[model samples]
Target: MINLRQAVFYEYVDDGVVEIFDRYKWGLRRLGVNFSQDLLETIVYCPHNLENTFMAFCSWVLWLKSKGEKTNPEILSETLMQALKSDRGWIPYDYQKDFLAQHLDILESPQLSLWKAAGQQLGERLRNRIISDISEEGKINFHPNSILTDEEKEKIEAFKVYIDQLYL
Candidate 1:
């Protein structure tokens, strides 16, 4: 099982998932807006890249720190929607570089390498576990029409819950 209390960027990202939902919930509640858990989950895990995820997370941290002073639903939705947009020609920028450096410039410094390494390890673990659980009895055989059984799906969902806990 993954440890949520670990002082690692990946762990922080996991916590960010939880924090984002909490912030969204509070923001919507304050705005008197109705929302569903599925929508929250979609946005929470919607970012397709590490940079976007970090950006969304940074926004979450900022919003959380703001307390109830600035809980505009329109602004909240816009910020989160921007985070989910595809990065076209925008040059990648690590805004959280100061908080958890990921710049892999060997000539510059290596302190941020720890975050990079931890991210890689955590990502691999998540990928491997998902693949293993989705396979049939540890076998990788699958046809184009592969469809998970109800029991298999349930188990996969359970595994996801376990993985989600790693974020908190």
Candidate 2:
């Protein structure tokens, strides 16, 4: 069986996954083989099996790290969607979607701040929906299909302006 802890750690790296690579690099290195190059290549080329390939790569890296092998830290996934996006060069679309759906909430939360932050980073459209969702008492929802109404859009714009003024 694959080691989940290690897999998760590697997933973090593979996705560029976050800003914690340096913090976790040493731990990953302690696991095993230098699959950084291979893993990175796979991620860039094999879009179809991105999740599985990533999971397997993470598992192997973790296993190797635990064994005191010389593994390079190179796994990363920016977001669930980015990880699951279909790549014409590899695997398949359905597989990526399925994998993303399976682990949709690895680091997500229902907090409005978190959603708002994500929305801000993602763009105004996303931020608007996030605000609307929060206003509607649907903060627990994380699906991409979630949307905001026209009123919510105005609210988001107003909020953005308010925030910008603070910076200015």
Candidate 3:
């Protein structure tokens, strides 16, 4: 089981030479948000591969609920899909359509409330994670070759704004 990440970057410092870097892992770390450990382990071991879809759906559910909106399957699905299309330049989209369909089914199932509760917990973690990441920006390591360009920095800031809107 992979433990939850606690830092924005994974670094190996060998006499000031940097090696072994992964931007994908860095992005996941920066997001620093995920389902509970049990749920994450279950998703990883599940017969099907729908982890991203399930996460997006659950997070959207949590977002809507946090905004005090009563959400249904249709609303949850549509809202998530729209966010994916509109604000997902930074998010990966390699999951199959069946993955999303599975989440839609879960949304309509008797387990919806349970998942929402999990999502609520995740949202709280995400909120705190975002705050800490921003506050402790100076502590985050950057690879020598991985410095952000102006445009990349802008995009990251844009993503921060978008995520802030979602969770705020």
Candidate 4:
């Protein structure tokens, strides 16, 4: 079993590789070996190069596996979404969008409670951003705006679809 508590990233950077603490590296290495076989296709099709960020994501997959969840693209995408959420106050770096935890505990576990919190936070953040954008636009003209661009229309439709999937 992988030990989440021992997943540590060192400050020293060597050739852009994140150096895991000596003791923790063993567990991570074992996790990596197991992950490489099952998630090889995921890594191949991923847009970004698999680095420490990918490993961090694998940790969540490992956790989900421990809970009997199967490894699949949808599960991986959902886990990535939860990891990248801005509302996870425990993450120190604002730009860090991975599931690499500074410290692991029951509260930090990627379980039902954490997923719910992340989803709520995401909704709140989007609502606030929309309100802020409207406020910055100044006076409300209350006029019918120009026809939506194809991209804009697609985005709106996509958001609606996302909302529907949120409950599924």
Worst 10 residues of 3 by lDDT: 15-24
Query: lDDT for model 1, on a 0 to 1 scale?
Result: 0.40
Cα lDDT tens digits for candidate 4, 8-78: 23333233222232223333333333433223333233333334444455455566666787566555554
Tens digit of per-residue lDDT, candidate 3, span 1-168: 122232212342222111111211222222333434333333233332233444544544444555788755444434433433443311324443344344343333222332343235335443233332221222222233545558655654565465455444
Q: Mark the regions of model 3 whose C-alpha exceeds 4 Å error after superposition.
A: 1-35, 49-52, 55-59, 62-138, 141-168
Query: Which is better, 2 or 4, measured by TM-score?
Result: 2
**Ranking of candidates on lDDT, top first:** 2, 1, 4, 3
lDDT, candidate 1, 87-140, per-residue tens? 531223445444323322321112223233333544544334334222211122
TM-score against native, each model: 0.26, 0.23, 0.23, 0.22
**RMSD, model 1, all Cα superposed?**
16.6
lDDT per model vs. reference: 0.40, 0.42, 0.36, 0.38
- Candidate 1 residues lying further than 4 Å off, grouped into runs, are 1-38, 44-47, 56-74, 87-92, 99-168
TM-score between candidate 2 and the true structure: 0.23
Error of 1 at 83 (Å): 2.0
- TM-score of candidate 4 relative to the true fold: 0.22
Report the error of model 4 at residue 63, Å.
2.9
Best by TM-score: 1
